[model samples]
Structure formats: structure tokens, C-alpha cells
Target: MKGRSRSTGLLLVISGASFWGVGGTVAQKLFQEFGISVDWLVTARLLTAGVLLLAVQFLLKDRSQVIGVWKNKRAAIMLLIFGLAGMLAVQYTYMASIHHGNAAVATLLQYLAPAMIIIYLVLRKQSVFSRQDFVTVSLALAGCFFLLTNGSVSQLSVPAPAIVWGVLSGVALAFYTLYAIPLLKEYDSLVVVGWAMVIGGSALSFIHPPWQMDFGSLSAEAYLYLVFVIIFGTMLAFWFYIESLQTLSPTETSLLSSLEPLAAVFTTVIWLNEPFGIYQWAGTACIFGMILLLALNKKKPAKSNDSVENEEPLRVS
Candidate 1:
């Protein structure tokens, strides 16, 4: 039973990561081949996925968490900030990265969030600097530089705007990772993430309403891709990752999720025929190396910050 549980956890993590990677790829396809607007897609994804997840939580999990969260004005306010600023910003920046570049680059770029989180923790006095942290930061910086510049300052291999958006996505993801911990401990993952989606989506709706987009103009295939993004990418991916937490430690879960970017790179290069040079591959290796570096660090007694009650923010990627 122990072996079976471990295997199940591994499978769940792999599936979750793969779905996220493929979902990003499909999103890129919609943007590049189908002319789908990022605004419409992001809005619809957040709103629809949020409603679906909350409905599931209400039916299958804790119903009270649905309303209980809002009963506390303080917790509700933090949730609101997480939803509107963290969720909305991360989603928008991530999609924008894929829009400017390929899924591979965007996903790898977002992996920098781990390093950013480390720095934030240190600055906030939540965590102290370690040798491992120094190594992680070095690899991340070198990897990003090589991936973007390819060892020369003469020209950029990737678009400048894509890099900006990708870095922003990492920053936003760091915020999501750190801020959602308290909420996740207090409420179901679905409650926190679901409401966050609704809040963020609603805010963006005012900027670019989902109804404003020409849905009819898109091909049936495009609609299918969009559905995949909402269901498989956003909802199911998160579900599998959360389920894995039942058996795996947070560190193990995070290390395994490095597969997300690897899957993205493979799909983007092979399926999408995107150009990824040797420098990019090296950069990918560095990012993955950092993941391993963190995961292999000596484990300590779980704390609110390290514990995964229902979800790890890594799932959000």
C-alpha cells in the first residue's frame, strides 16, 4: 500500500504537470493560429473555471468554506487582494508571455518564481540565506541571461516584451505562492482558488468583458482548445496536483512539478516547431537544476509556510 501510494502520487503529479504544459501549448496555438484575443480567453478561463471549481467544492467537499470565508472581512480582504492582484496579474502575464513567445519559453521563464520566492522570504525575514539559496539564485540568473541573450549583447534571441512579461509572471506567481498559504490552511484549496478566480475574472471583466469578444469567429477547433485550457489546464491540473499532496511532501511535489516546463519545451519544439537554441536548452537545465537543489535540501518539520493542506502554489503554474 505504501508503494502503491507513492506510485499514485507520482502519477498524479506527472499528469497535473503535463496538463498544464499542454494547456499552455494549446493556448499558444489559439493565440497564434486562431487569432483568439488574450483578454477574452483569460477572462473566460478564470470565470468559468472558478464557477466550476466552487460548484465542485460545494458539492463534494466543504460547503461552509464557500461562505465562511467571506464572513470574515479581514480574511476576505486578503483573498480579494490575492484574487485581483496576484491571480489576475499572474494569469495575464503568463498568457502574455505565451503570446509574445512560445509556450516553452514562457513556461521556463515562469519557473524563475521559485528563486524570486526565496529572495522575498529572505528579505521579509521569513527565511535566512543558505548556500543552497545562493546556488539557486546563481543558476536562475545565469539561465535567464543565456536563454534571453545567448551569451551576446548584440541582439536578443527572444522578444524583449516577452521577457518583461515572463519576468512579471514570475513575480506575480511568487506573490500568489506566498500570499495564498494562510488562506489555504484556513479553507479548502478550491475555496481560496475558486473565489480568487471569480474575483480576478470579474475585475478583468470590467476592463475587457468576455462578451465583447467575437466567439463565433473562432473555429470549432479553437473552441475545443479553449475548453481544454479551462478544464484540463486550469481545473483538472490543479486537482491532480492537490491530490498528490495527500501522499507527497511539499518539496517532492514541487520538484516533480518541474516536469511542467519540460513538457512545455518538448511540445512547443516538436508540435509547434518553435526555435529553441542550445542556449535556451541550457537555461532550461539550470532552472530544473534549481528545482532539484531546493527539493534535495534537508527537510524540516512542516510549518504553515511549508505544509500543503490542500494545494501548493506550484499547482497554479
Candidate 2:
């Protein structure tokens, strides 16, 4: 049973990552088709996703749980941060990074959050620095270099500002992933995510008022893509992510999720006819190899072996 649960959790994490990858690509495509700016897309996505999430939560949440969060102002505040920083900040920085740099470079640097997660875990004394961890980080970094440079070290240079913003986005992502874990202990993951979306989306909506949104201007395809982003990208992906956090360490989950970039690369190749150089292929190989190593090298606590469970904030602006 334990093994089955672990397997299911692994599957869920992978699926979540896959959803994120596809969602990103699809969102990019929507931008191309709809002639919408990233700012508008980001605004629309968060608004729609937040409303849908809150609707589901309100209909499905237990009365007792609702009362608990209502009274626990501390948890409510923390969750608001979770939405603002964890969700909105990361997404916003990702867009900023791309505008400041090339999309490929932005994407590569943004994923540096995995390394940040490992560092934070080590600092918190959450886990010892296993050789496997080091190897995974090294391999992942190598992959990023290859992916961005197309395997040529000569072409690897990114704009300094872009690199800085991308790394900062990564840092924000790490904190968001870390700080929110504790809140999951007290609230249902769905309710927590729902509330975070509502709060965070509200905060971001003020940046671009929904009153300005032109619903009549949207094409059928664009609207369909929006629904896809809200449902699969924001909702289900986060649900699986929080569920995986119950059984996986921050490092474990982050490393496993490194597959997301690889998924993106493949999508680009298939959809955009992007060519992969030898170095890019090598880096991709290393990233996947390292992920497998981390998965197999994980240590289960002897006392807590039967426990399937247990479940941040830094401003990244």
C-alpha cells in the first residue's frame, strides 16, 4: 500500500509538471493568436482561475473548515501571501524575464528555483546534502546552460538584468513553495489554494482592472485556451503539487519537477521545429538522470515510514 501510494504520488507530481509545461506553451500560443500582451493574459488568467477556484471551494468546503480559516487571521494572511508571492509573483516574474530577455533564457533561469529550494532545505536543516542532491543541481545547471546556449558555451551569455530578474523570480518561487507547506497542515489543500487564489488574484487585479477586460473581443479558440489555462494550469496542477508535497520533501518535489523544462523543450521541437544541439541533448539527459537518482536515492525515516504525510514568504518584487 505504501508503495502504491508513493507510485501514485509520483505520477501525480509528474502529471502536474506536465500540465504546467503544456499550460505555458498553450498560453504563449494564445498570446500569439489573441494579440494580447502578457500583462493582459496574466491578468485574465488569475482573475478567471481565482473565481473558479473560489466557487468550487465555497460549494465543496466543509462549514467547519471555512469557520477555521475565517477565525485564524494568521493563516488567512499567510495564505494571502501564498497567492500573491507564490502564485502571482512567480508568474509575473516569468513574464518580466521574457520581456527583459529572450523567452528561452527567461525560462531557463526561472527554473533555477529548484536549486534555490535545495539550498533553502539545507539551510533549514530539513535535509543533509546528499551527493545525489549536489549531482542533481549540477546536472540541472549544466542542462540549463546547454538548453539556453544550444550547446555552445560561446552563445551562453544572457543579459545581466534578465539574469538578475530571472534568478529573483526563482528565489520568489522557492519561498512560495517553502512557506506554504506549513499551511497545508492546518487546512485542506484545495481550500488553501482557493483562498490564496482569491486573495492573490484580487491583489493583482487591481494592477489591471477587470472592468477594462474586453470579453466580446475574444475569439472562440482564445477563450477555449483561457479555460484550459484556468482549469489544467492553475487548478489541477496546483492541486497535484500540494498533494505531492504531502509525501515529498521540498528538494524531492522540486527536482522531480525539473522535468517541466524538458517537457517544454520537447514541445518546442515538435511544435516550433526548434532544433536541439548536442549540448542541449546532453544537458537534457543529465537533468532526467539526476531526477531519477534523487527519486531512487530518497531516504525514508524509520519512525515515520508509515506516515504518507506532512506537509514561505519572501517578497520577490
Candidate 3:
């Protein structure tokens, strides 16, 4: 039974990561091929997914915690910050990256958050490096350089705006991973993430209303794609990931979640017919290697709570 459970968890985490990857491709199509805008999609996605996940949390998970965090003033403020700055920023910057570049590059760049987190910890004097940490940092930087510039230091093949957005996406993801820690410790991951979505959506809705999208211009397929982004991409992906964490450790889960970017690259190249070069492939391998190294050389990471305790709150949608 334990073997079967572990196998099931491996499958779930892989599928969840894969779904997130494919969903990004679908979103790219919505941006590149269709006239749909990122702001509109984000507003819709967060609001819809937020409501759905909150529904799940209330129905299947804890109900009181939904309202529980609000009773405390500091926690409530922190939740708002996490939602607006962390969740909304991460989602918006990521989609903007995809809007400017392909999903493959954007997803790969977002995966750089592990590197950013390491840098942040080092800056805060919270961590000291081992040989693997040095390797992880080197691989991450080299992977990013190759991925973005294809080994050219002076020139960038991808647009500069795209690269900027991608890097910002990574930074925002780091913030999300860090900011959600206290909230996750206090409440269920689902509860914190659900409300974060709602708060993020509500905040973005003020800037760009969800109801403002042109529904008439959208095809049935486009609508279906939107539904997939909201349901499968945002909601089920996170749900499956969090569920998988029940069986797998954070190190294992994080390593396996590298499948997210690989899946994005494959889907973007095969399904969307986006061009991917050999250098990009090597870069992807390097990034994946960093994750593998972390998992293998587990040294009680500086902030295990972000990954182990929270488990699945950091899904970059």
C-alpha cells in the first residue's frame, strides 16, 4: 500500500506539473493567436479559480480557517500583502512574460525562483553555502543566460521586455514562497491560497475588470481554453500538487515539479510549434539539474517551511 501510495503521488505531482505547463501554452495561444488580453485572463482566472478552490476548501477541507485568519489584524494584513504583491504580481508578471515571449522560456525563467530564494537568504544572512549551493547558483545563472541569450553575453534572442518580465516573475515567485509561510503555518494551504487568489483577483479587478472582456469575439474553443486555465490549470493543478505532498517530501516534490518547465517546453514546441534551440535545451537540463542536486543533497534548506510545511502554495500560474 505504501508503494502504491508513493507511485500514486508521483503520478499526481507529475500530472499537476504537466497540466500547469500545458495550461501556459493554452494561455499563450489566447494571447498570441487570439486577441484576448493578459489582464482580462488574469482577472478571470484568479476570481474563478479563487471561488472554486475556496469552495473546495470549505466543502472538503477546513471551513473555519477561511474566516480564521481574518480575526487577527497582522495576519489579515499579511494575507492582503501576500495576495496583492506575491500572488498577483507573480501571475501578472508571468503572463506578461508569456505575452512577450513563448511559454517555454517564461516557465523556465520562472523556475529561477529557487535561485532567487537562495540569493535572498544569503543576503539576509540566513544561509551559508555548501558545494551544492554553489553548483545550484552557477547552474541557475548559466541556465538563465543560455536560456535567454542562447550563450551570447551581449545579445539576447528573446525580447528584452520578455526577459525583464520573466525575471520579475521569478522575483515575485520568491516573494510568494516567502510571504505565504506564516499564513500557511496558521491555516491550511488551501485556505491561505484560496483567499490569496480572491484577494489578488479582487485587487486586479479594480484595475482591469473581469467583466470587461469581449465574449462575442471569442470562439467556443477559446472559451474552453479559458475554462481549462481557470479549472485545470489553476485549481486542479494546485489541488493535485498539494495532495501529492501528503505522501512526498518537499525536496522530492520540488525536484519532480521541474517537470512543469519541461512539459511547457515540449507543449510549446510540439503543440504550439514554437522554436526551441539546442542551447535552450541544455539550459533546461541545467535548471533541472539544480533541482535534482537540491533533492539529492538535502541539507535542511534554510527555509524548509516554504516547501515542506506549505507544500503546494507556490504554483506559478
Candidate 4:
């Protein structure tokens, strides 16, 4: 029974990560082929996914917690900041990276969030730099160098704007992961993430309404892709990852989650025919190695009451 449970967890995490990875590629296709704007897609995805997630929470979990979060002034303020600064920023920057470059590079770049989080903790004096930390940071920097330069420092393989957006996506993701800890501890992860998405989507709607898109320009296939992005990519991806945590250890789940970037690279290169250099592949390997190192490190610094293991939120974008 235990073995079967572990197998199910492995399948669930793999499926969830793959959904997120493939979702990015599909969003790239919409941007490149269908001329979809980042703002519109971000707005639509957040709003639609946010609503659907909240509905799930209402049905399966504590319904009061959905609106209950807004009742607390401090929680409400944090939620707003998380929604706009963390959620909206991460979503927009990631989509913009995809728009400017391909999904493979953008996905790998965003995975740098773990490195950024480590740096932040050290700077904040919350954690001391250990040998593992040094190795993780070095791997991340080396991966980034190879990824952007593809062995040539004089020129970049990806556009400057894409690189910038991708880095910002990583920063936003770090903020998103760190900031959500308190909320996750107080309320359910679903309630916190769902509300954050709604708040972010609601705020963004004023800038770029989801209804502003040219419906006539989108074909049936394009619409199907869009729906997949929101439903499978955003909602089910998060749902499956969170569910798997019930059976799998956080370390195992994090290691398996590396499949997200792998899936993105595979689909972007094979399905989208995006060019990936040998050095870029090396860079991807470095990042994957860093993730593995972090996950396997058993002597990690102790966190506060809001340890990441309490609620390991999956990256929705």
C-alpha cells in the first residue's frame, strides 16, 4: 500500500509539473502565433483560475476561510500586497518573458527563484551561508551565465528584454513564495492562493480588461489552448501538486517538481521547434543540479513557525 501510494504521488507530481511546463509553451504559442498580449492573457488567466480555485475551496474545504481572510485587517493588507506585488508581478513578468523569448528559457530563468530566496534569507540574517548554500548559489550563477550567453559572453542567445523579464519573474516568484508563508499558516493554502489571484486579477482588470480581447481573431483551437492554460495549467496543476504533498515528503516532491522545466524545454524545442544550444542544455543541467542539492540537503537552516514544509506552494506560472 505504501509503495502504491508513493507511485501515485510520483505520477501526480509529474503530471502537475508537466502541466505547468506545457502551459508555458502553449502561452508562448498564443503570443507568437496568435498575437496575444501578455496583459490580456495574464488578466484572463488569473481571474478565471482564481474564481475556479475559490469555488473548489468553497466546495471541499472550509467555505468561511475564503472570505474570512479578508476579515482580518493585517491579513487583508498582506493579501493585497501578495496579490499585486507577488502574484500579479510574477504572472505578468513570466508571460512577458515568454512573449519576448521562448518558453524554455523563461521557465528555466524563473526556476532561479530558489537561489534568490536563499540569498535573501542570508542577507536578512535569518540564515547563515553554509557550504551547501555556496554550491547552490554557484550552480545557479553558472547556469544563468551559460543559459543567456550559450558559451559566448560577447552576445546573448536570448533578447535583452526577455532576460530582464525572466529575471524579474524569478524575483517575483521569490517574493511570492516567502510572503505567502504567514497566510498559508493562518488559512488554508487554497484560500490564500485563491484570494491572492482574485485580488491580483481584479486590480489588473482596470488596466487590461479580460473582455477587451478580440474574440473573433481567436480560432476554436486557440480558445481550446487558452482554456487549457487556465484550467489545466493554472488550476489543476496547483491542485495536483498540493494533493501529492499529502502522500509524498516535501523533499521528494521538490525533486520531482524539477520535471516542470524539463517538460518546458522538451515541448518548446520538440513541439515548438525553438532553438536550444548545447551550452543552454548545460545551463539547464546546472539549475536542475542546484534544485536537487537544495532538496537533498537535510541540514537546512531551521525556519520560523512558517516553515516552507508547512505549505509548499507550487509555482502556478
On lDDT, the leading prediction is 4
* Tens digit of per-residue lDDT, candidate 2, span 1-317: 26877787788778877776667666656665576666666676666766665566567655466547868889877877788878777777776665555444455566666566776666766666777668878977886676556656676544566667677777877777677766766777666666666666677667776567788998998878787766887777766775676666655676667666666666655774555677767766765665566555665323342221233111111
Each candidate structure's TM-score, on Cα atoms with residue i matched to residue i, is 0.93, 0.76, 0.94, 0.96
Q: Higher TM-score: candidate 3 or 4?
A: 4
Q: What TM-score does structure 3 among the candidates reach?
A: 0.94
* Over 4 Å off, model 4: 1-4, 302-311
lDDT of each: 0.85, 0.65, 0.84, 0.89
Q: Model 1: per-residue lDDT, tens digit, 1-317?
A: 26999899999998998999999999999999998888888999999988988998999898999999999998999999999888999999999999998788888888898789778767766666788779999999988988888767798889988899999999998888878878876888889999999999999999899889777787888888988999999988888888898888877887788888888989999999998888878888888888788777743322445532234544575
How many Å off is the CA of 45 in candidate 2? Answer: 1.8
The TM-score that candidate 4 achieves is 0.96
Ranking of predictions according to lDDT: 4, 1, 3, 2
Measured with C-alpha atoms, the lDDT of residue 267 in candidate 3 is 91
Arrange candidates by TM-score, descending.
4, 3, 1, 2
Who is ahead in lDDT, 1 or 4?
Answer: 4
Number of residue pairs clashing in candidate 2, backbone atoms closer than 3 angstroms, sequence gap of 3 or more or interchain? 1
| Model 1 lDDT, residue 24, Cα | 93
Displacement of the residue 123 alpha carbon in candidate 3, Å = 1.5
**Model 2 TM-score relative to the real fold:** 0.76
